[model samples]
Target: MRGLFEGGRICEEFSAGYYGVCAVGGLISAGTTHLAITPFDVLKVHMQVNPVKYNSISTCFTTLLREQGPSAFWRGRGGKFFGYGIQGACRFGLYEYFKKVYSNLLVDQNRSTIFFLSSASAEVIANVALSPFEAVKVRVQAQPWFAKGLIDGFPKLYASEGLFGFYRGLVPLWGRNLPFSMIMFSTFEHSVNFLYRNVIQRRKEDCSKAQQLGVTCLAGYAAGSVGSIISNPADNIVASLYNRKASSLTLAVKKIGLMNLFTRSLSIRIMLVGPVVTLQWLFYDTIKVLSGLPTSGDDRTDVEQIRTT
Candidate 1:
């Protein structure tokens, strides 16, 4: 892996062109990972919305395969393939871009503040780009009978619900992602810093290629678990709203009820998210390395500790 990016230069300075590369790398890496995990996501949705039918992961897999065929596992992947591609690209690219911007503004260079603001800003932009496809994705997953895929779903949604339908769940989506990104990114940054300083006793820049990947996996899992648990409630609302269980936000919450909303599929999310996030960061960082760009979330204390001293 290191040999592939051996010619890659460490960016001592940020540039617009480099940011563009980061965006492209982010897009490809994120899109690939999300698409690859679509089957798991499909299973997760079933577990969330129709726990009785799905019950367990193994049961869901066999049920979908038996009833809907192999394609059933990827039922609504179109939206995720495209929507999350853009979301991943923006989330990563803008995160790096914003971190630079924020760091320049603050003398103390607080990692938590920078991570929160940058991740939050990126997520807002990413979710906007993601909403339409995400709406389509959720709808297709919840109502597998809705349409076969994006092509069918997009047209069908527009015809039945008009333009507003594509964005119906935007509020809940935002409600879910914002805090998720905040905790996820901030925790990831802190985790990386902690792991490198305390665990590895070395800065990120000094770590071997394999070491970097290991840290990313550990940090991603930790961040994903916390982020998913915190955001699952809003996530439930998004699923419910898009699935037609409720017409409005108030009704959606009312329909879901407090206990079910919070606890529904909480374990599934943590289990699913831990690996998904771990792999996402792994792919995202590896792509950056192969693309000759700076590693994601490596701009904090440990790296700075090496740079300043």
Candidate 2:
């Protein structure tokens, strides 16, 4: 178990220790958090698709409970759990790898540039990995009759739309996620830096475990709120595409119109994303600790080295 956790034994030259720990942490944290919030996802999707029917979060919750029973909220949770698990692994692992690479290449190694470039790259990879499952998840969420879970959705989607169907919403998914990721990672990095140095009066690495966890959650929430606002339009379009089985991006945009896309259900989404992101970071950092690895924000030594070099 320790050997597996170390990850170095398997791949000695690949920053195995860092990659291994982060991959495991990211996978477990994101997958579990995503699944845990499956109910909110169901509400958010229904509300997004049919605002008149759902209206507000409280109403949406009760409506679903009354119509579909408690289990309905968890209808497609399995897809989210496994889908986000892969997405998280790629996101965190590749972000770190790219950051290090960019650090070595850039003469100044500015944190902002590294954060943006690395995160953008990571988001692209993560979204591609998440696309198929996302298609299924959205279908199930938008129309509860679509499929029961991952097992049913996969084959059903394949039979109906074939291979391309699984990736039907890939473009919108990328459009929605790219900015969100860019905003999220850059915001999270800077937020942690600000809170630790200015607010907490301690460097990130110098903080105690509880302090680190608190900082992670705060930074994650900040990132999630901003990211949600910036990406909500594309998010709306993506949901519509899946729910309506629409293909043309232009038509989707035309049908939704600009104002409707951003205005409908924005607050509910922000509320949903904020705590979900906070919990993901909290769980991710906790996993790091249990695995005997450094927390995500504790990169002072690396930053100093980059500055000197």
Candidate 3:
């Protein structure tokens, strides 16, 4: 069993050429999903910060359309694409690399442990990698009144904040992303396997592309929703933090924690972000499943870590 994972066969067998292919696919998959669901993201944030002004996602979207026009949804489209594109790319790429690295660092295991640790380690690495991009994306996305589409948000951020600006929300970004990534990937992989092996075993092997796709979508959605709830507040903090010009991470944390920090308005945040995340996960995992991206595999144990320059 140990030798099996260590063999080159697993990599070759993944059907994506090598692990790197999955990373590339994951990047593309995540990017398209982010683009599609960004409008909800915009609305979610608004709801979190200013709930009274907006009642619901639909109502908020409609109001934004009425006042600012439909184009409002794309307020920070540029930052999202490039920022999140790079993020997704790095995330998937690094996750594969890190999973292998961490797995090998220790020793062998069954598929379950492998799936959990590899994914969790990979997620941490990926989240760390994404800090700067996330900072940029949040900054871009937060500014409600950017004249052009989301792309313009990048130039605006650069013009206003300089290099450091791109990294503004990194601390909070990590706070949100690290846990989110760990939970999301681990759960998604496990969920898919659980369903296929037990709940839906009979059809998986003979599954048509469409059938596999359907299962993947469900797994992805479940994992994504779980991830979103775990990750939202950190996300909000990252978004809020990036827009500021704080001197340091400590300063930023202090700033964000000005009121109660950990105890800060939970009920409101949930009411706003909960629905958005639910939909966001549904849409996001759907993209991954459809695109044939890297997912947690059957071997639920340790994954060998590999690195790329």
Q: What TM-score does each of the candidates earn?
A: 0.90, 0.89, 0.70
For candidate 2, what is the TM-score?
0.89
Rank by lDDT (best first)? 1, 2, 3
Q: Which tens-of-lDDT digit does each residue in 1-309 have in candidate 3?
A: 111123323344234454555566556656665676667667765554444676666677787789777766675555556556666666765666666666677565654466556666656556555665565555545555543443565566678778776666666767787777777777767776677666655434355545555666677667766776677657646645665634555765565564434333444445533443344344443444444433334423212111110
What tens digits encode model 2's per-residue C-alpha lDDT throughout 73-166? 8867987899999999888888878877887898486778888898889889898899889889988887778788888999999999899887
| Clash count list over all predictions | 0, 0, 15
Candidate 3 weakest ten by summed lDDT: 300-309
RMSD of 3: 7.6
The CA lDDT of each predicted structure is 0.81, 0.81, 0.57
RMSD of each: 2.7, 4.0, 7.6
Residue-level lDDT of model 1, residues 11-107, one tens digit each, is 4337876677678767876787778888888887777777678778889889889988888877777787788889988988898888888888975
In terms of TM-score, which candidate is stronger, 2 or 3? 2
Error of 3 at 124 (Å): 4.6
Question: What 10-residue stretch in candidate 1 is worst by lDDT?
Answer: 1-10
Better of 2 and 3 by lDDT: 2
Distance from true position, residue 43, model 2, in Å?
A: 0.8
Which runs of model 2 end up more than 4 angstroms from their true locations?
A: 1-14, 298-309
